[model samples]
Target: MTNRKIVSPSDMAFSYMGRIDFSKPDSPLFIYAGSMVSTKFTGTSVGMMIFPHLIYKVTWIGVIVDGIQYKFDLNHSDTPVYIPIIDGLDEGEHTVTIYKRTAGSHHYFNFCGLMIDENAEVRPENHEYDMNIEVYGDSVSSGEVVEAVNYCEHTDPAHISQFDNSWFAYSLQLARKLNARINCNAQGGISLINGAGYFDNYIGMETVYKQMGYEPHFELTEWDFSRYTPDYVIIALGQNDANPDPKRIYEKEYREKWKSVYKNMVLDLNEKYGGKARFIVITTVLMHEPTWDDALDEIVNELAMDNVKRFKFRRNGAATPGHPRIPEQTEMADELFGFITGWES
Candidate 1:
């Protein structure tokens, strides 16, 4: 018989890569796209103890070993269990990174712990994040429909769990390009204000930003700003603000209220970063109303803070009617990366 070693959430051998709730350090909660847990093992097998989603049966996770990548579903129909990710690796030390490719919109499970062969040696990751970046946006930033490659430049496949993969998200891609730790706070239909967006019940990023993506599907704690403040906060709202909703975009009051709230929201984020970090506000290449972008320009101007600047894409509104695919995500990442590094294309 083989002995088993349980790695609790608080185990030093585990390294967290995103804004995971650590109240129960031994079994932390994961929210948002790109949230991850990483570690290395000396044996051929390792597995995850997960509390699966009750409603959505399709939960996708990106499991990377050394340089190879694989995907798995974590949504179990019953109680939490030890789900083996990869059990047949070479019998030697191996590094593994497991991240949520689907967001709270798709899965709402918190990992319980990790199981490894008792004789195996395990250790935390060695990579150091010289910089930290936080992103707040809607479906585009959440990697929704990114794998719907067949519909590029047109429209997304009807929102399906199979199509969403945060690994291909521009925010995560940008993090990889810049070699930074990221807190990607994104949802599928969130907008800047509380009452406008593709999401039902007016669930906006403004409300979700302060919490750990709390929804009826799961339990989460209020975000402790002291935990993971960033050097830069990237805001990607406004794309869905013009969606047919509780707010009428054509009205002057609607535009005025939007700009006001938008400015205040940035100010709130600036304060969260201790008023020293910068805010790079932007919209995506996904086709949208000129009014939303126009209002953003006004908001950035009104803020008048040197650290808060709006970065525009060369092909912003000229890209596609559907959610951006992997190619467009890379294109956007290139432009944003260039802007951040102060490099001219």
Candidate 2:
């Protein structure tokens, strides 16, 4: 490690993907899954330093070196620690991508910098994505329980974090499938409205969509939406809105109020990201009550915004009793790819 040169996290050589809060002193905070940093280095290895805030659960990182993908676990430490994302390559030019692969609720990491071989030259990666997508979603969008291959279509395994990987989430998969830059503004067990979901304490997307980090115990910075603009804004919420067998959806007052708030959210985002931003409101392939999607349809109809569209996955609302596994996620992604592309065509 002696000969390694440190690239400060604030270095312009890093190409950022997704929503990263850069307001901190030393480094930026990687706030959501699929948020990534990409750079090119002419060296045999590259690593990263991060201060992990592991309060709820352990978080994981995903690295793509010269296009090969793999997972890296963050070091469990109260202070900054170095994790070798990629090493043992021939001494030459190589591209590196480092991303958070789990939701922030599990933990959020403060990026310190990149540890690069002193001899190597670090440069910004030049990548131009034709499409930009921002998704305000719940656990399904966050890729929760996606690694539970053995328990696909069934209840998740007793141990959750160990098997949760956002890399396989349909949202990420769709982005990859379509070669787009995506902001996965998603969380696990999160609802559209506050104080909802099956979890004992569920954080809602309405509360988190504008915040830097979701740690309730800490006062976090509000996200500046001026940073990234999206051609498409997908709202994949509603799965957690009514949990533990609630009658909220059944109540006429609650239903109308929910639609009003939801419609306004779409209107705000449409105007926020430029009035022409196309909005796709949808539910997932999970086995949720159809009323949620029904609500979405009602909003789309009421708004009648030419840019707003409603879509349902081929198996939306009836995919599985458990979280959608990798295959199921991919299934949804495939359909979505066709749907989006076909819509464009």
Candidate 3:
């Protein structure tokens, strides 16, 4: 049978708890948070029309069909690329879900639509969740280099592209445990004040947080805060701000500036979303910077926002050369889950 069937975005169920531009229904924008597409279909093959960004784009997406995971690279493609989902499945109803495994800094993808076996019958499935969460941070939150077997295995950019799995990240893991939809606004080497030393000319999280997409080349689509409100907002930052060296430990001025920026960020978020969501600020897991921890405490106390709280991840051995691996990510997720549940109870 000819596999020439095409399905519109409207025909498939989409569950993304982030800001998406659906102005053009034909090409829905997918940013952070694992945007999911689910449909029950009778087909032997399935495909997707994906438009990747041209620069600063490195997206790792996973297509889960019937519980199996398949990862793909959606980056640097100017035109829409036709991605093969899978072939040779039994002729019956099957479910498929496509989720972003990379963070927002890598950029976003424009999902044009889907194509399947010409004879198959496809219909949307309801995959919505009752609760919503959002996570904002740097590499640790993005699940960067999480799959590296050992420190020696993490060498260069290629390794990051291969091992990074946002699906396994702490934010997503916690969301899954709570049965909540998540929005992940994280990048590999991002900070709030200064850019992480790893990347040259890197933009900080505070600056990029307002823009629609990560890369500068992409058309600016200012995020519409009204799109999806989260019940919980987890801020996993400070590591990048500390970057190559712990500025909070050695530089008093830098420490004060960090505190100021964090205070402003929290206040801004509280002002815009305070009425709807509770805020949880977190410290880095790689390094134990007491000054940074103190700074976070000060921010919370200064804000005195009844809904805001603070948490810290106990330092763990590096998962890779400089990033957290699967085990560390799992621990972080567990800690977060316990904290959130404890508060809710």
Query: Considering every candidate listed, which one attains the maximal TM-score?
Result: 2
By lDDT, rank the candidates, best first.
2, 1, 3
Per-residue lDDT of 94 in model 1: 92
Q: Estimate each model's TM-score.
A: 0.94, 0.95, 0.87
Q: Candidate 1 vs candidate 2: which has greater TM-score?
A: 2
Assess each prediction's global lDDT (C-alpha) against the native: 0.81, 0.82, 0.72
How many Å off is the CA of 73 in candidate 2? 3.1
- Let me know the TM-score candidate 2 reaches against the reference structure: 0.95
Window of ten residues with lowest summed lDDT in model 1: 212-221
> What is the C-alpha lDDT profile of model 3 across 1-345, one tens digit per residue?
264777787664544345566877888877764555567777778878888763444556778898899987776777888888888898888888777666655657777777888877777666667688888887778777777746532543455366778777887788888888877787777777755434336677777677666654456567777676789998877766656676444677876777787777777776777477899988656654566677788888888877999887655323334566677778889988898899999
- Better TM-score candidate (1, 3): 1
After the best TM-score superposition of candidate 2, give how far the Cα of residue 271 lies from its true spot, in angstroms: 1.5
Q: Best-fitting candidate, measured by lDDT?
A: 2
Q: Superposing every Cα of model 2 onto the true structure, what RMSD results?
A: 1.7
Model 1 segments more than 4 A misplaced: 245-247, 343-345
Clashing pairs in 1: 9-26, 10-25, 10-26
Better of 1 and 3 by lDDT: 1
Clashes of 2: 0
